[model samples]
Target: MAQDFIAPSILSADFARLGEEVDQVLAAGADIVHFDVMDNHYVPNLTIGPLICEALRKHGVTAPIDVHLMVKPVDRIVPDFAAAGASYITFHPEASEHIDRTLQLIHNEGCKAGLVFNPATPLSHLDYVMDKVDMILLMSVNPGFGGQSFIPSALDKLREARARIDASGREIRLEIDGGVKADNIAEIKAAGADTFVSGSGIFGKGRAEDRNRYDTIIGEMRTALASVGR
Candidate 1:
């Protein structure tokens, strides 16, 4: 694997102060700033958009913005995201009617293009475009909302995706998002995920039983991640 794991998700950040929140995480050495764009029709929750990415760039956020679009008719929105200065634009393969062309459009815009797979989506969906994209996102949880628990089955999917990438002979980056935390991060890393996305894992209020243990959990996650050469 690679020593580049921490991709902090902005979904768990205080959106009212998004710029400041982004700066804080960037200052903490976060590799990519993960942005989740949700449409109510596609995932039941509606969230940020291209304007936010433009705003982040205006605010001088230098970290690459990883845009994860959980919406249908994704083609209609890719251009706006690219124009908004998104360094990497990823769309759900299940949501697009023509995944190949959509990915090509993203690449043509001079940005790294990627595809996202919901937990229930099969690994084979990536077969055609597996070599064409710069990265592949495997959702470890359902995509609708933030703060959801990580699904363990996604680890098996990650393993399979790694196999696919390896067999394809392409150096595509593999990212695991949803319900990621300190304890299981190593599992995903061992499974060949170099990029890790943590929403509730890094910023959600810690478990009620743990009582104000967020910092501890974050530290442990970082330490474990560091050991894996991430």
Candidate 2:
């Protein structure tokens, strides 16, 4: 089965009502919560960490929390996020000193492990650790900020990555992050991305006072992906 998943990035959600936003999005059919963990050092942006992840759990949001570690010294935070209720944890290969060990650590903590490839990061990172990953996140745009235009080169990269995953014979997910919207989602899926992460593309579309647009935008994306039988 082609499992097309839509993970709404909480980085663009209303911070004051994060729990509500998460509840609503999940209710609206989001597969996962794309939690952005940015350290000021690694990605030139400082965002939330395990504390908020924990809070979300405490708030009764039991959906999978897909934590993206945009931080250096990634190993130390692995245990924290795992303890805080993360279901899937992914970190940039360039940020981790020992890629295999980091993936091992995440698995050891009882979460699905993944490796993130930045817009310019090489696919060679997957050469040794493909066996260790549950998902491969391809950044369609740079990591630091949201709302950037999708980079077209990602289509080729996704196709190449898809071939590698198919050859690996593992059920690893191919996730595309940044600038995903309804219009281009089908093309992205056609390129072999089964999972998606969209920040401004979803949250930025609604009027400031209305968060219910989450359902509308997410449904549109699902419809787009479904139209092609993804």
Per-residue alpha-carbon lDDT of candidate 2 for residues 95-163, written as tens digits (9 for 90 to 100): 888999999999999999999998899899899888999999999999998888999999999999999
lDDT of 1 by residue, 1-230 (tens): 44655788888877787787677666655678899999998899999999999999999998888999998989999899999989889988878889899999999888899988888888777877776798899998888888778898987898898889888888788999988888888887877898989877766644357533455655677787677643
**Model 1 residue 92 CA deviation in Å:** 1.2
For all predictions, the C-alpha RMSD in Å is 2.9, 1.2
Give the best candidate by lDDT: 2
Evaluate model 1: give its lDDT.
0.83
What are the TM-scores, per candidate, against the unseen true structure? Answer: 0.91, 0.97
Runs of candidate 2 exceeding 4 Å displacement? none
User: All candidates' lDDT scores?
Assistant: 0.83, 0.91
